[model samples]
Structure formats: C-alpha cells, structure tokens
Target: MAPQPKHKNIVQILTPVVLFSFFSSSLAEIFFEERFEDGWQSRWVSSDWKRNEGKAGSFKHTAVKWPGDPDDKGDDCFRHFAISAKIPEFSNKNRTLVLQYSIRLEQDIECGGDYIKLLSGFVNQKKFGGDTPYSLMLGPDICGSQTKKLHVILSYQGQNYPIKKDLQCETDKLTHFYTFILRPDATYSVLIDGRERDSGSMYTDWEILPSCKIKAVDAKKPADWDDREYIEDPNEVKPEGYDSIQREILDPKAKELDNWDEEEDGIWRPPKVPNPAYKGPWKRKKIKNPNYKGKWKIPWIDNPEFEDDPDLYVLKPIKYVGIEIWQVKGGSIYDNILLCDDPAYAKQVVDEVFANREPEKEAFEEAEKVRKAKEEEDAQRAREEGEKRRRERDYDRRHRDRDCYRDRYKRHRRGYSDDDYHVS
Candidate 1:
C-alpha cells in the first residue's frame, strides 16, 4: 500500500459536525407553535378568507381553523404555502439538488385536488414580460385519493424526471411531518418519513438552459390547413334496403373514381370483347358443390346461373327452382323481379321491418324527451313547494305578532279605564 493517507486532527474532528449541519439544512423541518400566536412565523401558512362574492380573497395568512367562512361556495382546498431554501443555484455542471418538507392538508375539503409543489431556480418574469418562470418542480399532483400520501418528482432542465413516491401517512393529525429528499443526477431518489421510497433517472440530452431573453414565437394563421374550397352537396336519398344487406356484396371502400370519366377523348372506357360466353373469374375453387348427401333431388342447383349470380338465385322459390335462365343481351330490364320468390311478400316484409324499427327509434326519442321534461317539472315543483312553505311561515309569524299586540292593547285599556273616567 502507498503511504497511509494523512488525516489532519482538525478535519477529522469537524467532519461530523459539518455533515450534520448540511443534512439539517437540507431536511428543512417545520415545527408548529403550541399556542395560537402569530402563525406567519411558522413558514408557508395560509390566511385565505371568504368574501361576500363567494370567493377567496387575495390576502393569505395563518389561522387555527379554516381561514374563512365555510359557505364561500368555492372549494375549501389547501391554501397554504411552502418554502424551501436548501435548494442551490443550478450551474451548467452541477446536477443534483434536493429539498424536503412536511405537508398536512386540512381534512375539511375533498382530497381530489390536493397538491404540493416544490419550486426553485427563481426568475423574475416582469422584467422580460414572458409567461413562464425559470424553475424545477417535484411534487404530487394527487387527486381522487384522501389517504395521506407522499410523492417524489424531479425536474431536470426543461423535461420532467419521472420519479414518484406514494406513501401512506402514519397518522391523519394536521401536525404530521414528512421528510422528502430529491436528487437529479445519474438518478432521482425520494425519502419519505426517513425511508427511501422511489428513484428514477433521465437521459442526457434534455439539458435546456434557463434564459432571460424573450423572442417572438410564430403564431399559426387560420387559413393554412383548411381544404374546403368549393363543393356542392347533392343530398341524395338512398333506398330502404340500401344500408341493410347490400353492404355484404360491395367492397366498402370501392367507389367510382372522381376523375375516371374525364380525358382528352369522350368518356374514357376500358377495352371489351363482344359475344363472349360467360367464362367467369371463378377458378377451380368454384367447381365443388355444397354438401347435400342426396337428401333432396335439387338438380337445378347444379346449373351455373345460381353460381354466377347468388343474389338472383338464392331467393328463387322451389317452384321455379329448375328454370334455366337465358342471358339477356344488353337490353336493360331494370324494373323486373329477377327472382321467382313471392316478390310482394318480400316487399311487405322489408316495409314492415323498417316500420317496426321506426317505433323503436321514436320510442327512444320520446323516452329521452320525457326524462328531460320530468326533470324540469321536478325542479319547477321543488321551487313552487319552497315558495309555498316560505309564504305559509310568513303568514303564521304575522298572525302570532297580531294576537300578541291585541292582548297587550286590552291589558293597557283595562288598567287605565276606571281612573280616566273618574278624572273626566
């Protein structure tokens, strides 16, 4: 080993004291006074008072109970303050800064919006007229949980360091103290109530510098992104069965291409051959028949008409099952029933199906309207009942006062009558 490292007596004697002082300052514990004396000296206290406008006034101080009248209408969340002086100024190289304090929120309000934010790295925005102040934040944005808990968060440069602590408090009394420590270096760690609860680290490139200079950032103009130039809507009405089963036959995304008909020549068309037999696009896969096991002599099903056009064949009644259909050469027969089924019955069924659906839709709308109407009616009735009760109470109070006044007048007249008559 090299010569034993020299340790001066002075350094050895003072090391523990220096370390203790450093830790004591970093801890920054708050002690509550026993009596109801000046609460301001007990750092980060609130003096929020309820004003006549049902809002908390700007004046903040310290008090024993909640600072204002309880009927302020706004939330009675914590209006206290927090101060941490242990955090040091950030330089380019220095990485770690930690601050810890005890926070106890009054249980009078809902805990949904309770939060504790440790702020440091101060900057004056009034000098630059900028929106954000230069600081780092590490705290809990606790909402929806009332159980006392602790949180650890780190803010390095501009991005948030994702480290958190959720610890159940040992007690619920307002005087509970929790010690928190934050370190933003190779990692961030938090100690809650003298125990380490969480830690996290951040990537290196996120070191954004705090600057006092302000410059004009670009504001986007509204016209850049809009594409609605000029297009007229035809508002076409589709047939009843259009949305029902027709979607099964058509590829949903396939629509007529907008510019397909436009070209240098008149109505551009694809090349076609005339007088060709129906050699369909189906291959060997279409040759196999469905499993029947000779149960019924359904020989007409083997013909290619059923295979070529299922929409036409599947609906044909058993009477026309074997009828062989001929190819109609280019004469458009649009207004004809292609299938041999009872077309009138099919039409009736389709109409009746849509008609039945209409009542369901109408009933849903009616129910919604009725619910809304009932709610309004209930509110109106409540108001009327309240007014009636107030009027009845006022009448009863006036009647009581009138009877008391009459009795007092009779007593006075009886006392004065005999003496007054003799004197007259």
Candidate 2:
C-alpha cells in the first residue's frame, strides 16, 4: 500500500477531541449575566419596599476606586439596597448549576450582608425584599469578627437550609470572586477568588432531608452497665496532717518598718504569701477499673421518617436573580454576576474578567500608605500650631504679671495707700 500522509493521520487522531470540545461548549448554557454597563437600569428593577422608611439604599453605577478597568462598572450599594433582574426561566434538573459573582468591599464593611439571591417562580420585582422567597442564596455575610463567612443556602420544599460547613470569606478592601457549583449528583463546590474552599455531598452538608440513620430512642443503658474507665485506688489514703497544711503563710523575709507604731498602725503583720509546703486539696490516685465498661453508645436504627430523594439537588425554576442586602456602612460594589450550567465557563470568566485583583490590591495598599502619610502630616502640623499658640499665651501672661508687680512697687515707693495699688 502507498505510504499514508502524516497530516492525514494527525487529522484523524484530532477529530474526536475537537468534536468532543465542540459538544461540551454547546452543552454549556448561560441563564443570566449582569455586568452593570450603561443601559443596565432598563433590565434591573429597584424595589421601593424600604424607600418610605428611608432604609432603601441607592445603587450607583461606577467603577472601582482603585486600579481596574474604568469601563468595568458595577452596582455600588451605599445603604440598604433591593434590586433584581428577571432572567429567562430555567430548570437545572439534571445538569450542573454554577453561580458566580465578584464583590468589592471598598469601605471595609463593618457589618452587613453581601449575598445575592436566586428567586424562583413569580416575583413582584417592585416589592422584592428580604422576605421574598428565593431558591438559593450565595455570598459573604460579614458582621465584625464573629460572622465573616460565605453563606450558601439552598431552599427545598418551602424551607431554606444553610450549609453546615464554616467557610471563611475574604475581608480585605479589594475585589474578590465567589463561585458556587451544584452538580446533578447532589455534590456541591464552593470557591473563593478562583480557589476551591469547600466541596461535599449536598445530602450530607445540608439538612434538607432527614437523616437516613438515627440513634434508637428506645435503647437505654442497662442498670448494671458501668461506663467509667477509672476508679479511685482503694489502697491510697489521705496522709496524716495533710488537712492541717495552710494554703497561705506569712512571708519569712518580711519585717515590720521601724517607724510603724503598734497603736497607730494596728497589729503589724507580714504579708501572707502562697505556702510552698501546701499542696491543693488531696485527690486519690486513679487506677484502671477492672470491671470498667467501654463507652455506651445507643444503637443506630433506620429512620422511619427518612425518605431518599432522587431529585434532592434540583432547585425550582429559577427566573430572577436579585441583590437584596442590608448594609450599615455601605461601599460594596457587586459586579460580574453569572448563572450558568458549566463550572468551566465560570472559571474562565474568573481567570479573564476578575484576574486584575492582584493589581487592584497593590493599588489599594499604595493608596492606603499615601492616605496614612497625609493624616500623619496633618496631625504633626496641628500639633506644631497648638504648641505655638500655647507659647504665645504663656509669654503674654508672664509679661502682664511682671508689669502689674512693677506698678505695685512704684505705688508703694510713692507712699500710696495699700488699697490704691489693687492688682488687676
């Protein structure tokens, strides 16, 4: 046979890979994406639910304060904000769902929630608030030191269940990306700044369903059961005079002062210090109990109430994505929200769009240094001015006092009455 061309062989080998890539890209679908560019207000609905109470915050479309793409504007929340955008209804019944977004806590958020909610079904976009029903909520909730965690809450059967895992969130005054992926197999993954922070089965991580096995309530410890592993040694007894040892004793080196009088100073006593010879209350030595039983555990039985859910990972038809937050001191900028069915796409967005975080952080640190330097300089100038004023006041007061004294002396030399030379 004639020799086969090398290029033909290479093309034959690469055909399957290229086809697979094409199919994979076609399968990935994006349900919603918000970049907060111009004309974004037409797509988003700002709720007036708290506006009458003056609690509704306004969102300004602006770019990051530090170094970043000037055209990359985000929704800047200055207070309590409730805004949402309607997305095409989609069901993630048998596919992976990815929710990703970027947040910039420019004000170093003291206490507030920076989470976004995915609402299912019909929602009055004009009245969307905290009470609005949502299928999923994902983002960081910061409240001082105690609450600085990224929350991942999934709603199932009218009840919302929060993730049991404690995931620490980024608290720096810079932009960060938060990504969450929920697979059809009931497994979920949480990522922060493009790094996987946590991943596990949704069945185990969330309390959406009853446990498959539970401790038997009917099982009880028998009357003869002995769970203690150790007992006091029978041969050990309290030593003689042990109870008489005092916890505190007079210092031997302390001496009464020579000037101290017995009647005036009361009875002179040396300060009491911790006694060296004294041991604390006696404790009998422990010995391994011969008849000791191991820890008693109630037998686990199949939970009758437990029911396996084949669709435990399925959320309702998500139709709207919202940003409803309550911030005390707000300067959080939310941007680049994406809802898709492919984690790979979400990761690519992070690597491309949100990759300027390192530069943003560098710019923030440099700005902070400049601000601190300016504050210190202003403080030093204020101090110098204050000292100058104090010196001027002191000089005037001293001169005035000397003049008064000289006038009194002159009056006295001239034989004026003592009352005539009254000091002012």
Candidate 3:
C-alpha cells in the first residue's frame, strides 16, 4: 500500500482524543519509558539461561498481573527466553526515532521470535545472548511456511540493514501495538495497534540508504544492442510440402471392417486420411523491429556510495533497549516501552499503555478458559484417583483368594496339613 504520509504537523487527533496533547513533538523528548514497573528487576538484565542449554530461557517478571498467572498464561512455558535492557541516551543526532512497544502473543504463535530489540554498545548487558550486537531490530518474526515478515533490522555504520519492507505481521493472539518512526527526513513509519501499516524512505526504505542512483559503472550494452523486439517476416515464406504431414492422423470415418475378406482381410484399407490442407509445421509472420533500440538503458550514475543522506535517519547514540527474543510458544507480554523523539510521544505511549490491552486480552481469554478447565479437571481427578486405586487392589485380591482356598480345604481334611500355610 505504500502511501501513508500523515506526518504533516507531526500529529493532531482531537475530537476528545487528547493523545499526546496536540500530538507532542515540540522537539519531542522522553528518551525512555519502560513500564515493567516494579523496579524492573533492578533495571532489566537476565541471561544465565538454563533449561536444556543452547538458547534457553529465564528472564522473568510480571505484575501486569492475574490471569492463570505464568505471566498471564497461554503458551505455558516462557519458551526459551532471552531478555535485555539498558536504556538511557537514545540519540537521533537532530531528532526523530520513536520506538514504541506493547506486545502480547500468549499462544497461537507457532515457531517464534516475537521481535523487540533496539540496543547500542556498552555491550555486555549481562552478556546479552542471541548473538549480541544490535542497534535497531523491530519485532514479529514467526516461522513455518517461510516466516511472516515485519522485522526491520537497521544498524548502519557497523552494518545491519534489513527492512526493505515486506512488513505484514500480527498473527492472532491479541494485544499488538508496534510503532517505529525514525525520520530525520530520511523517513519511515510502521504502526499497528495504533494504525499506519507502512510508510517509506530511509532513502527508499533502507539498505542503509546508499543508491542515490547507481547502475552505470559503465553499464555497457552496445554490441550493436538490438534487443530483438521482433522480426521474422521478410515476406513470409513456407508453403511447399510443410513437413510431409504426419502427426497421428488415421481415423477417417473408418467403417471397412465388415465381413472383410479381400485376400484374407489384408487389402480392405480406408483409414489414413488427414490431408485437409495440412498446415502442420510452417511459421513466418513477426515484423516490428525497426532496429529496436528501446531496451538498453545504462544511464543513471552518481552513486559513488551515495552522499546526500540528510542524516540517513540518524542513529548511533542510542544507549539501550532490549528484549531480544526467540520464543517458540512462550506467552509474550512486553509492555509500554517508549523510547522517544516523539511521533507524538510514541502516540502518547500507545494511549497510556494500550489502554489495558482489551481488558488485558479479556483477562487472557478468561484465563485461557480457566486454564483449559482446570487442566481438564485436574486430569479428571487423576483419572478418578487412579481408578480408585485400581478398584481397591482388585477387591483385595479377590478376598485374599477366598481365604487361601478355605485354608487348603481345612488342611486336606486334617490329613496332617503341611507347613501351616507357610507364614514365616
């Protein structure tokens, strides 16, 4: 859809809206917001990851409380987590870079990475995992069926790039709300849960803005470049005996097999008939190539690695912002982080933290239907208490085998019973 301009007076929204008080941006300030409340684990930092090694989980914390709790339940185990956080100096040279947060997968996210990262050096934030090194990484990655876009990488100076926009994220499970901005005149936007789907120009949506016109390193094309627009008709010729016709023909109303006895039925032919002005393999009519010089452009030049970047959407002062991911079925629930240069204060922190994400996703779907009906009623009362202790151990082993078969028939009717039922 490539057309979302709307940055005019930065923002306005009124009719009793009051979001960002006249759409913020008086040189927009607030460079950090993180509402993980409760001292955010002393400013967020976890990475000693355990559970089955290689890319494991552990970053915990949640007071966005209630809902069958494992951080507001859904996809049970925080599926192989990875957390990060630093926050402080979010520079944009002369302003413009407005990340915004508030996610919420909570299940139905098969094959992971619920995006979120916006870091910048000072590195080792408790040895941040997932191959540390970040500058800009926006969320929602999904897998299976070759991933569903909306990623947005962008490191610039030290490389990174990504985000040529295929951006189509939000796959179910509620509570979205992403919103990047960038803009120091290099342009970019992208919002969800707050509108706008896409917007361009990090010099045409990013490859870190280099091509201000390339393609002509002597793009070369002249070996008499006629690009063949069309030409076989030098007066169309091909009519004499067009390949002696023979492409499966014999079925000319054949009815000569009746009581045929011409020399023992070997001479009553009448089948091979397909010469109806047979025009099988003869072509000759193309025409229009007056030395067609129209498909050979090698022009455009001037990109000595381009130069007019108007601060290619500046960066490189960002202090920190992380949430590095890789969840496979972990209940996601990031909340109102608001690093800013204010696209109206990240739309007024997404209307005050996503206005209770639809009543916290309807109380996490009624606590996932009361946690799947109390795990199917505690697994049907542990399968009816192990089927009542296996029917009381098969009714006390059938009444103790009928009292040891009536005491071996009264010790063989007092015929000097052997070892008295052997009870040592």
Candidate 4:
C-alpha cells in the first residue's frame, strides 16, 4: 500500500462535484429563445389578416433609443402587427414551464399590450391574430389609468381564465424582464425584473375548477332569526320639541331697506336662513340588541358537482410563440425571449443579458433631461422674439398716427378743405 498524492486526492474530491454540475445542467431544457438579432425576419411570420384593411403594423428590427446591450438590437414594434414563430413542440407535464422576456416601452406607451402567447396544436403562423387559440398568455398590459397590470392567463378545458389577483406591472420607460413559472404541483409564480412579484396555487388563483365546497341549497336562515346586531333603543324617547324644530328661520340680523315701498312691491319679508340650532331629521340611538344573533349564513357542504383533477397543471403541447397586439403609439422594444423549465436558468439569463437596466435608465434620464432643457430654451426664445415683434409693430403704428396728425394740422394751416386732406 502506498499513500496517494495530494493532487490526486483533490481530483477525486472535485470529480463528483463536476459530474453533478454537468448532469444538473442537463435537466434544464430550453424549448425556444429569441434574441431578435439579425435574421429574425426569417424566423417570424407576420399575419396578413389586417393588411387589406391597413390596420396591421409592421415590426422593425431595431434597438431602443438607449441601448442596454452593447449590440443595441431588439424587435421594434412601431405599429399594430401580428407576428409568430414556430417552436419545438413540448408539453409541460410533470415539469416546470418558464416563460421569460424583456420589454422596453421607450415611447411611454399610453395604451397598448406587450403580452406574448404560447399557442398549442396546429397554427397558421401567417394568419395568427387575436383569434388564434393559445395555451398561455403572459406580459404587461397598460391602458390609461385604470388598467396597468401583468396578465397571466391559462387555458384549461378550452376556456381561458385570467388570474384572479390583480398584479401591477412595470410601467416605466425603462427595460423590464417579465417571467412566469408554472410547476407540476399546480403552483405558479410571476416575476418582474427577476424578482418574485406574486406566487400562489393555481387552484386558489384561478377559477379553473368547481369549488370543493359550496353553500347548501336547502340550508336557509329561519324566519325568526334575528341577525341584526344593533337595534333602536325602545326605551329611549325623542326630545319633546324635536319634531317641531324648523329647518329654516327668519334672519335676526335682516333689516328692512329705507327705500322699500310696501305699495309698489309686496310687503317686505325677512329672508329665511338655515337655523344653526336646528338639527336634521332625528335618528334613534342604536343599542346592542338583547335577542341579537350573529349573521345567519347558509351552511357549506361538500359540493357534489366538484371533481378533482390531478393533471390540472398540465398544459397542451405548445408549438408556437405569437405576439398579436394593437398599439396606438408604438415604440416598444422587445428582446431576450426565453422559454425553458429551469427558473434558475431564466434568472441567470436576466442577470447576464438584461443586467444593464441601471445603465439603460441612466441613459434615458439623461436624454430626457436634455430634451426638456431644449424645449424650455426654445420656448424662452419664442417669447423673446414675440415681445420684440410686438414692440416694433406698436412703434410703427404710433409713428404713423403722429405723421398723419401733423399732415392734418399743416393742411388746416394751409386752409385746404377737410375732404382734400385724407390723412394718407
């Protein structure tokens, strides 16, 4: 027997760790990814459904005004367009499904949708529009002041169900990453900019299935049940003069005008004013009812119509990723789309690729500052020029009037007829 070298022992210890890392990486699968680089036009098909109507807008392969990436490239959707790309068919059965993407609303989108859809079954990529059926739809939708939320809709049993909870989304002009993860345990999580914004069980957040318990149809409150907790005090009596109190009274400070004539005008009467001492209609003071009972409710029983679904989390096989939106004012740059099973991988992509958010924001702020300053400068110049023009016009009009007056005086001294001096 001989002692092993130190390097050989280190190698033996590191070998298993290396092998585990390799195998762990293999577990994560990337079904589709779109960086929106050159050659993106070849992969995507634009719909012609609204082309004849001239409602379909085209997508530009460009970059945000401020470049977060060194390569400054993304899918610029400047108008309403429906575009889709075919992805490898895959089902999220007994596995995690992750949808991640980055969006930059450079145009300060007032009303538009930035959602992406995961379509299942056969799809006509060239004609995919709002009517196309999808298995999942996720992203932010901003419309005026009321709607500014990240949508997470799932299709189950041929019906689409949006998340019950209202999840606020990023509405700034900077770039943001939206991530959605659905696991095999019927649990889903929503992440914005690589941080968890919301997470819950699908059963609780979506009305995909009938409730496990429902109010019993036969259960009803008894006719004699006193559900009211408070009632008017029977023993309390109203003040004697409460009913006689008038809401309006003649003003004590009002005085009859000295010129007021009772013969010409109707007899002068004091104006009625609101009486400060008079309270509104009387209300009886409430007291705890002696016979009061808690609120009566129909008792819940096991719902006979409810049926459990073990595979409720499983979605149909998705084969395409589509984007169909109508933008009123479009300058949204979409980039770094990814669909995979591993959340860690998605986060890593965000960390590595979309990490320049701070820089992008700084660039945008700098540009905005410059733009505002320029506008202010232009406004000030316009005001100064307008004032100068106004002064020149006034000076010219005054001088012209003075010259005409002098001419008229001279004509009078010359004894010319008034009609002959026309003040030219």
Which candidate should be chosen as best, given lDDT against the real structure?
Answer: 2
Candidate 1 local lDDT, residue 124: 28
Model 4, residue 335: C-alpha shift (Å):
1.1
List, residue by residue over 304-345, the lDDT tens digit for candidate 3.
777785666776777777776665543566666677776766
Ranked by TM-score from best down, the candidates are 2, 4, 3, 1
Q: What stretches of model 2 exceed 4 Å from their correct place? A: 1-25, 217-297, 396-424
Tens-digit lDDT track of model 1 for 3-55: 32122100000000011122323333222111112332242222222222222
Instruction: Show where candidate 1 strays beyond 4 Å.
Output: 1-60, 65-96, 111-122, 125-135, 145-151, 164-171, 183-185, 200-424
Task: Write one digit per residue (lDDT tens) for candidate 2, span 1-424.
Answer: 5442222100000000011122444667989876665577889898987877755656554445664543455444345678889988999999999999887777766688877899998999989998999999998889887999889999999999999989888888776899999999999999987889999998789998888889998999989888889999989989999999999999999999999999988999999999999989999999998988899999899989999999999999999999877776646667778899988877777777545656667788888999899999999999999999999999999999999999999987899678886988
lDDT of 4: 0.79
lDDT values of the candidates?
0.31, 0.79, 0.67, 0.79
Q: Could you tell me how far off, in angstroms, the CA of residue 132 lies in candidate 2 after the best superposition?
A: 1.4
Clash total of candidate 1: 2
Q: Sorted on lDDT, highest at the top, how do the candidates line up?
A: 2, 4, 3, 1
What's model 1's lDDT at 141? 33
Model 4 TM-score, 2 decimals: 0.70
Candidate 4 differs from the real structure by a C-alpha RMSD in angstroms, to one decimal, of: 15.3
Score candidate 2 by lDDT: 0.79
Model 4 CA deviation exceeding 4 Å by range: 1-24, 216-299, 396-424
TM-score of each: 0.28, 0.71, 0.31, 0.70
- All candidates: CA RMSD (Å): 36.1, 15.9, 20.8, 15.3
